[model samples]
Target: MIRIAISAALLASAAPVLAETHSIEPGDGAQERLQEALILAEPGDEIVLAAGRYHITDGLSLDVDGVTVRGAGMDGTVLDFTGQQGAGEGLLVTSDNVTLRDFAVENPKGDGIKSKGADNIVYHRIRVTWTRGPHEENGAYAIYPVESTGVLVDGVKVTGASDAGIYVGQSSKITVRNSIAEANVAGIEIENSRDALVEHNIATRNTGGILIFDLPNLPVMGGGNVIVRNNLVVANDTPNFAPPGNIVAGVRRGTGIMVMANDNVLVEGNLLSGNPTAPIMVIAYVQPYDDERYNPLPREVVVGENTIEDGGYDPQLDGADMLKAAFGGELPPIMWDGLGSLYVSGDTPGWTLGLTEQGKGLGDAQPAPLAAPAPAADFDETGIGAPAELDERLG
Candidate 1:
């Protein structure tokens, strides 16, 4: 009896120690209630979800500071955006220090999950798909984060996202590793971001595999996008159907390693092969042909020590035709080692992987001063396109 009393006392003491955890069932407007859960969740709360389908139309939003949401498992839990009333964005998270792991989101009207203005967020072992398969208007991204920082996205599998799979735009201090992306408009694009480490990512069978771009037309400048050691980035054949009678530029078509207006960027220790066109590209977006830019002034870009196993351009073909076929007509032909029996487009002038004088020019080996990296505090993850000052990472 005394021993039983002691056990009861111990159990009572431990009861308060248990952290609060909540569960939301399938039919409970799981999408709407997700917001409530975030409101109620404390720093370290876990929100466990049951194994069932949650149709998200309005979508799940998060502003909570720090929380962890885990599904039963990737296959064990499914968040279906199918047949939802309006456009579906399965989950949109805009919080800091959050984690959403081990779940499946499908057929989101927009991007499956867009984590904007976020920091230190992790989407681990998550799967995104479109059950209806690859539709041009299906959704933009499987997992898209903008202006985020200190993020780690791993163990993600994305299929049939319309725009891109796993797009990180304007983020800093990020890492995207051990993920697989396939059958999307573009696979794994890191745009206008800085100090990012991308490794061990498999981008295959998509329109563009493993792209890093600094879209120059925008008012805000974009630079410092990096691509690091990774596995296969091969043949990106998938392309959205063209609008009737309209032709889009191949400079924007199926490719591997697309970078423009990016500096101090690194592409090393990677295997890029079997692209229908150039397996690796460093192309100039339609910049001015005159005045102060090279073959005029100087801009910086770096492409180093990567194994180009097979495939590149066929410039004898009409550049327009080649682009429709997905050859980014960025760089001119090259000196073929003759290992693959592929003719080098060396006949075409002014484009080389490194600096050039006429087209796609950064000029000969003159170096841009190595700028210092910025601290995390100055780079805000909560705001969109914060001012790019020298003190910040974009600086």
Candidate 2:
């Protein structure tokens, strides 16, 4: 029995490491090949996608576990989505234990890569771009994650996204590092997630450079996060306009890194500087739950060790006065946006009223006056910008 065991161990140790590298060319029936290879792959398989443009209209869904999707680097491999449907979202995830590295996903119409209901996913050395020369659509986001956990998004360069360069919502246990979110809607957004760590990232010239929110109205909750040691969050307040569903609607015209309704969260050791808007904004909640089909109030939020560099000067949307006027004195650092909100900080019970949209015409409960007349720009980036333009503070 000892000799048999020794032989078995020797064989196991000497087993050949076969990592099948599948190739997917432009018209190589890449989808079909990928499915087959994924089924046959073991723990250490690599699907090598070659240098070419893969025209996927509906985008790709990656669900296989313990697999790696390798490409010919960001410069060589491209998933070009110039025009597509379904909110322009590309590469949705439904499984866990996935690793996608060294590739570029260009979805001008939708999100670059969206992972939903996934865990233990790693996106490394990836680049997502939506800019061709000077013309940039909504680079919605390079990485949009929802209902995911244990994620690491690193060494990525995202440019020219319309909404947010990287929007992470309803996720937990995440880390974003050594990445760049430039000239997009929002550089980095963590909404309704938990146990997150955002560090060593560069955010520049997107609406709300780095935003974290609880958004209790999302039917999801947010908390337990940290933003530490980042650099160059600047020039995000462009107010470059677009219509709803135009991709740009979600970004490129708002505060820098809006944080709302989160707890156990810390903003420490960050070099947030030179933005067109406030460098660091910690909001109380999403507010006015009536619009999102739920109550939009926030609670149990924390702020610490943050550096707010300015564009904080707005004649109409004066956050300081708004806080002092509403809450007697000294606002909650960050409060919820909009004039239609029904709740405030230090609340114990959740909202009792279900979300209703009946008050749109009735106007804000106390509209915030407009800073200036509504430019032909986009208002979605700043929920209160147009409201401020309307010369009204709903809060």
Candidate 3:
């Protein structure tokens, strides 16, 4: 009997720990309390932030896998980093299978919430804002996820990011939907990522609404297989406010949707209006690149049928007056650099720079009306978007 009891006790001790909730409220020493809760959380545990504004001094980090960080609501629970003295971001997560939901981060000094190498992460109903709006000194990216796979960012709102409002880089199997990005340099950006679905997002009043780029010399290369559809990209006329040395600083204002150096990209079913530049732009990477693995030209890009209105009426390009006159008072809705293979699914009007090679100037451009073939067939959408299981967490 004694031996049996000892064995039963050992078995109970070896069982998995029951998940617990750590509740934190905003008040004096909230910074320490919040940090401690995050640090002490175990896998399959939750840290709940109560409804109030948490005045944080330094960045908060979470390295525990399978942890959920919940807050009252995006508007009810605020993490104000206005007085932040240190750290490169407001919150950093380096673990996998983590869920962050219903929180607001305001005035982060650098990037707002960055998840690096955190796979299977979900960011839901979160808001990040720069109160002053559209300044070069604002945070570089509001919601940033890099070097990870299986990312889902849904129902999030971001504003006034100097670089990008919602940025996913070096990741795969990503989905960004039901989000609003406004007053940012690049509203929504997918950089050096593969198999991404960007849909049902509102991108407005930014320098560039949606940018899909594949740049050289990154840890991940060959961004491709992206689907951008059902988005409202309008009036992206905010001046370029990115830091002078950033690549996005060169992005012309009023660009609705720009795809550069990516392969197998599909742009369709979007509502684009009031973008003074081309509503849809497909271009090659013009900068000189040393990476042999990088393909600087866009390939197999298909611009399907989309609702475009009042675009290219006040282009921000050089010799806009001449181009307008040449195109009968307004340029086409679509603009291409004419360096790679592009197909328009329908009869959407377009124009091209008609450059023979990358790194060519506009002076070398033989500007002409876009003459591209229709897509051979429907774009293959297999294996795109975030994993379906990420939505289960929201329930």
Assess every candidate by TM-score. 0.71, 0.68, 0.96
Write the number of the candidate with greater TM-score, choosing between 2 and 3: 3
Off by over 4 Å in 1: 1-19, 86-88, 217-220, 241-254, 287-300, 313-317, 320-395
- Candidate 1, 119-184: lDDT as tens digits: 878878889998766666677789988877777787888988776788888787777788988877
| lDDT of model number 3 | 0.95
Off by over 4 Å in 2: 1-19, 26-43, 83-88, 132-139, 240-254, 290-395
lDDT-best of 1 and 2: 1
List the lowest-lDDT window of 10 residues for candidate 3: 1-10
For candidate 2, the lDDT comes to 0.57
Q: Each candidate's lDDT (Cα)?
A: 0.61, 0.57, 0.95
Candidate 1 lDDT (Cα, whole model)? 0.61
| Residue pairs in clash, model 3 | none
Total backbone clashes of model 3? 0
Taking all chains together, the TM-score of candidate 2 against the true structure is 0.68
Instruction: Candidate 3: list runs displaced more than 4 Å.
Output: 1-14
Best by lDDT: 3
Candidate 2 per-residue C-alpha lDDT over 1-395 given as tens digits, one digit per residue, 9 for 90 to 100: 24345436655898754555666676756655654555555455677888877766556666656678888887788877665554546676667767788888875476788888777777777888875611344545678877876777777888776666777778777777778887666677777777667777888766567776655445566454444345556666655433465323533354655555555444555665555334445333322444343333333333334454533443114344653354343222232333222222222111111222322321233433212111232212111111112111001
Tens digit per residue, CA lDDT, model 3, 297-328: 99999999999987699898889999999999
